[model samples]
Target: MIDEQTRSLLAGIGGFDPTPGALAGVVVVDVTRVVAGPYCAMILADLGATVIKVENPDDPDYTRTFPPLLTGEGSEPLSGFFAQYNRNKLGVTANLRTAEGRELLERLVARTDVLIENFRPGTMERLGVGPDRLREANPRLVYAALSGYGQHGPYRGRPAYDNSAQATGGLWSMNGPAGGPPTRVGTIIGDLAASLYGAIGVLAALRHAERTGEGQLVDISQQDSVVTLTENAVVAYTTEGTVPEPLGNAHPFVRPYELFPCRDGHVFFGGYTDKFWRISCEVFGGEGTADAHADLSDMATRFDPDVYRDRVRPMVEGWFRDRTKAELEALAGDLVPLSAVKDIGEVVDDPQIAARDMIVETEYDGYGALRTFGSPVKLDVTPPRTRGRAPATGAHTAEVLADVLGYSAAEIDAMRQAGAI
Candidate 1:
């Protein structure tokens, strides 16, 4: 839930707080550098957590060097990709491999409620910040571990990215149009999906620990999460002993549930119900059950889906061709389930998204203000609002050491000079 003050502020007609900077109280220690880990920490920061993102100086996040970093008045080595994923985080560089650095992290850990890291199995254990040590340091610390495989199994120690996970999990094999080779999803679906799952697990664990003073390690596998995105391919393989092929945008076993051509773009329409099928037929000026009954009525008849697809395609395509994106979204919302496959620009420019505050803008000191997607979750009393831009590397190192770890300025200066911070 959004806070009373925030809600009241938002309800004041014109606009609420355009730039709600810091989220007070909650603190998070982010031990991750790349996408999935940083994404989880960013979400926590958005939800009022004071996130401290740790980075190894020698091996900085690859994304930091992702080319042509944003330039501006207060912009400090900002990566275009990093900015989007790590909006509200404070970056601090530390050589965790060093004894002093590890001890510094331990001191920070003493004040952290949550820790996020994505590495191969036992990687953290080797680094001395594994769940057990973190728990001992802070008895109620909720640690989230995200990896390619998992904490166990033969491939647990393997490294992977979004493409690898999709291929290993059978999701790639189920992609593309029919007769196409296995292909990874266009977006980093596996990585982001695993992050979302990790976030949920973290919050759930946090709640339990807060209630009973018990903390647990959350194990999120990108491969396992990717497997869930396999859609109906595995079901067809196990149940009917049929190896499914690339289905593109259509359901493998369902008829009329596919994409069709539109005037400007494409429309994804159809559902499981016979009612929508009937309505679809009516939209094409054909009798609901006159010719499409073979695919509609007989469940087993889907074995030869091409026969019904021939008749259904032109019918839905006709309706889509006659309508615009706006018209299609409105009609779909009113009549049946449908969607306009608008591009990224279209999505960001949508008015409805604006009204929902789904698209937001925040001023960055160096880069002015830019609009981007908002968090998906909505809380009435504790809303997750964008709290300014990401901090510069080592920007909050002194402040965090002083405030959380209670280190003296002399000690902080020494740590900086040694390059172990």
Candidate 2:
């Protein structure tokens, strides 16, 4: 564990203090290739759990073909998008279709504490690394699987990605501008949500296994996960027979709760009460306007949004146009519930993000320093660190087998010669 390179990295950062140990002593065998699975593995890796990313030779992270390669060269092999998700771990490739590859995997599993994968339902079972087989190999191994609908459902075997989950999860139904076409969220929300839950399940299962020598299957359904975020939309549908529709930028039940255009960007003013609405009007120059009427039951009462929108829309538009984004934000003195829309650059440079180490640099010679996201989770005792740059495909194959799996140099060369990796 006393790696000179790792120690040097710890020293180069300003607040370097070496830890004699890391959390839980858990090692994750990551068979997750794309977004959700890789993202979950990365979280475990960031939390100081050793994660070994497993990929096949032919389809070694298809994200490498994504635009804006981390190397940023013409037709480079490494994509920035891929690097974004795969950082803080070791990458190894194998031709899993081969018997040698499967044997090698079974051997690796003997020492691995957890296994994570996001394959179509039954893919692992077909490969003989399914939940039952894997548990048979190591009964104490926590196996987490991510799929579209779930391990079993009408849609279990259907193809699914982020958008598919959003549509099926009832999330897309509640998105977009009011009366506009239902829209997908701009972010890969479903994938990220599932990843976060997957990581949580992995650690929880690991804890259980440590306590009782019992490992269980983590069945992650992306569709169900996105619905968790939709909250009352699901409740309203279940309780009131209401199908939630896209309310655009506005909240479904709250009037004047959406963004208004400023001279620069948009300023969002959210006051959930009529008293606050009157106060908002006093500030935004809409005091006695026809649109800014008070229901007395107030803005919080679920009422016809059309009436409120008609009363407040013009006044808000006129006032917002008179001020720049900064001036509008400033007027919310002592916090009048306002925020200006900011782009990614602004988010990256904001003082708060910098203070929290929300960004980290990956060192590569030609790439120099690659700016990527940092861990957001804060631990009081031992916080997460940017361990290292992502490894190239098969770059650590020989090294990992020799060191972690006890393969000889000659054995690795033989595996290489046999096209097993």
Which candidate's lDDT is highest? 2
For candidate 2, lDDT tens digit of each residue in 1-421?
Answer: 2234433332332221234224425667889877999989888777776667888977788886786765544345467777788876677877778777887787667677888999999998898778898788788889999988889979989989999999999899889987899999999899999999998888888889889888899999999899999968877878998998888777767766788888888878776566666667677664564244545335544246666566556656887887898798778634567788889898899777899988887776466667888988888676775646676787667766766667788888888788888
- What digit string (tens of lDDT, one per residue) describes model 1 on residues 83-166? 777777777778888877989888777766788999887988998878899889888888899999989899987888988788
Which residue runs does candidate 2 get wrong by more than 4 Å?
A: 1-24, 72-77, 274-282, 285-297, 300-307
Decoy 1 TM-score against native = 0.87
TM-scores, one per candidate:
0.87, 0.88
Q: What is the lDDT of residue 321 in candidate 2?
A: 89
| Clash pairs for candidate 2 | 70-80, 176-248, 177-248, 178-248, 291-311, 291-312, 292-311
lDDT for residue 4 in candidate 1, whole number 0-100 = 50
Worst 10 residues of 1 by lDDT: 7-16
